[model samples]
Target: MTNLSPSDKALVPFVSVDHMMQLVHSIGVEPILIGLADYIEADFKRWELFDKTPRIASHSSEGVIELMPTSDGEVYGFKYVNGHPKNTKEGLQTVTAFGLLADVANGYPVLLSEMTLLTALRTAATSALVAKYLAPKGSTTMAMIGNGAQSEFQSLAMKAIVGIDTVRLYDTDRAATRKAARNLAGMGLKVVECDSAEASMEGAQIITTCTADKQYATILTDNMIGSGVHINAIGGDCPGKTELAPAILERSDIFVEFPPQTRVEGEIQQMAEDHPVTELWQVMSGTAKGRTSADQITLFDSVGFAIEDFSALRYVRDHIKGTKFYHDLDLLADPDDPRDLFGMLKRATPA
Candidate 1:
């Protein structure tokens, strides 16, 4: 078999968060969403093509930190992210993430990026993609619960993909709601800053929950959500964290990215062991139905899957062209003599 030398391997491209943001900005959010959805759908259709594993999570008293890794033969990718709800109170983001992409052929890194921004983008894109199948046609207004960094991206992606025009926002912190409202101003979206979650849901066709609390909190009750509403559940992705009450899940048809993992993380974790839930890949592949009736409430339980991060990294690597901004890390050692492993390490470093 042909092999690559150390110097040859260092030439592989690397991308930082700033570079990735430039890439996303230059490519634009709508196009990125479309491209990511296509990649995710294509991979989903060939579900067996991937080397998948459930994410590894490190739980703390206050929150959780997770590592999600996956591969699709040619590429290996992993994201490092933490969920600390109390961080915002300390002037820190609730979530801060970074990820890397490597060539599986030689196990060389192709890119390294801050996934804090990319996560928001990918999660919103995944939400809109699910809504494309489940939300009623001509859906305009959306009620956004827990306005934070993710809220703006979610609103934009929904507008681009599913034709949402109005966003009614609510958060325990008024400033958070105001931030979301301000971000959407003049973007052709009518923003309503509501006092409570129920007020935000008034006459909304779509309900998006992206709150960042780490406890088992109920953001949506049976009384707030009505028929024909598509719920993009983004925040309640951990075992002890839930945004919707048990009755809400019992009444709605649930859709998830990956059922086995979602069963432990998504709102379905609150349901019975045998409770029915549909995998989104099946819906995209036409093996399952999305919404049966206009009055049916549909929920997309989003726990941020590795496949989504895989797709996002792939998109950035492919489209973020012509920038030589990445560093060359000496992650591997090369040797002309395969048997001299120790000698190769000695030669890898400078004298």
Candidate 2:
């Protein structure tokens, strides 16, 4: 094990962006996405075992920064991420991130990784994983409302995890829709571009809203959402940002990751403080109902919880086992004498 190698035992394995992309291509993006979904599902099945809490966020006029942390007794993980929707106009990505995994016993980070791509991967995987529990049977098409950075990943993830074979892409920016359509063309999924958001949902069984706006915008009104469909509401992930009309939230059975967190950041932020919602982990664990009737609507109000990031970190820590997809970063100080901290520093000065 690189983590146990004698000379490199103090080094932490770091997966860079190039390494991450290489690893994705090596394992295939679809399979890795599926793997991430499986890991997330497994973690959800044992939700009670994790020490869960809301992610801490620092909001700004143009963006937000967040630290998501979680632990499952044996290991701990955390991610540092930011969301800046206006950055797109400034020729920057809307989101960027990095994550770390540590041994809870020693509190030493075992793996550090570039999670910008992994966040996109895990978000899509989580959406598809929830759909497996809530979506209509034999779901094949998805209406992707926002065709920005996450659109293609969401399309491919649904195809790999939830049997989605077609995606209808819509965005206010035609270039984004075209880009999403172009990206998915070679991913074995049929992509259709639509002029309006309503047109995108015409025949789709699953509808995903992933706009990056940081304000209250009704991407889907009550009249637009039909029954027997699963809605993945991802963009309404902050206090003032919401995608669905309040009436749609009222009619749908909502599932969320953490109530305290989602109540502040998800679509439920539009509802009452006492509004009831099912936890997705409970639904996955069979302790709560996901979808009971054929004509009922189900909503997975996703706010990018910490447990999902933890699961992604866990999966990457394991999958890079025998591969050359990571670098051992000399991040920790290893002294010959455990108590000789000053001596260790002095030894490296001139010798």
Candidate 3:
């Protein structure tokens, strides 16, 4: 690799998985989460200026593959992600992703980065950012249902953004809860393990569900949730996959990222076509109401929108400018002359 010639060295910045972990550790995860939250909020506040649409999904019995894309007219970003719930049984992550950011002016990629970790980070940041507007004032405890890869990140993001310092973790698999609890230790948050989802909700004002099962599941029943709680439902992200009971959706004030997208992919998909729901961006823009009462139930039906991936890509592009965490990838062919394609290839060929 060291013998790479400068003549063939037109390179794009590439962030590998190892480098992403290094970047997170170097800048600190909470600070990055806060920074990403700021970017996401900024984008939401100016939600009218972007080209928005629902993500394109291709589904199968095993899982789903999706392409989430967005543009602010200056920069465009998209993430390629897959969800295979059965992958865990074979010793692999249930979800994995990669993303790219490009300059709209030149139509050339500026950065390509591994988005598996970034997705988890931005998802947690999005939840916490929404909770800042929807959660009850002085909320300090969160019930982390479905303790898996996202549980620790969600717990930390809430602590950083909404001032929650205690997280009660629960999972159908006890080992997942133990894993979450272990990862959360020394992160300045008190972590608790519970035997069931209902037990985890004890004394918690915020409940986050992040299971990876690709089916209709009642992680929380109507009777399990009470008044004055904010629910961050992160599991039910595709059609035929939902985490809350229909009765719970009926009573809560639901909020979503995009109506057209959420109607088909989010928890709101379980409701009627006319079932009322508010867009979170409207709340951020002060055009609609958020948490109006301390006793009101608030639900953030997050389906992992494209704008978040855009924002996360932008954040990485900005912070990684001077860092050594990225490598140069020769992904594009650079010809000596724009029109002399034959000559450029002939020159590169060994005689």
lDDT of 2 at 275: 97
Task: Between candidates 1 and 3, name the one with more favorable lDDT.
Answer: 3
lDDT of each: 0.84, 0.92, 0.92
Clashing pairs in 3: none
lDDT of 2: 0.92
- Model 2 regions lying over 4 Å from their true place: 1-7
RMSD of 1: 2.9
Task: Summarize candidate 1's per-residue lDDT along 224-310 as a digit string, tens digits.
Answer: 788888999999988888999999998899998888889899899998877999988888888999898999999998998898898
- Give one clash count per candidate, in the order shown: 0, 0, 0
Q: After superposition, how far is residue 350 of candidate 1 from its true place, in Å?
A: 6.7
State the displacement of the C-alpha of residue 205, model 1, in Å, after optimal TM-score superposition.
Answer: 1.0
For model 3, give the 10-residue run with minimal summed lDDT.
Answer: 1-10
In angstroms, how far off is 335's CA in candidate 3?
Answer: 1.3
What TM-score, computed on C-alpha atoms, does each candidate reach?
Answer: 0.92, 0.97, 0.97
- In candidate 2 the C-alpha lDDT for residue 235 amounts to 89
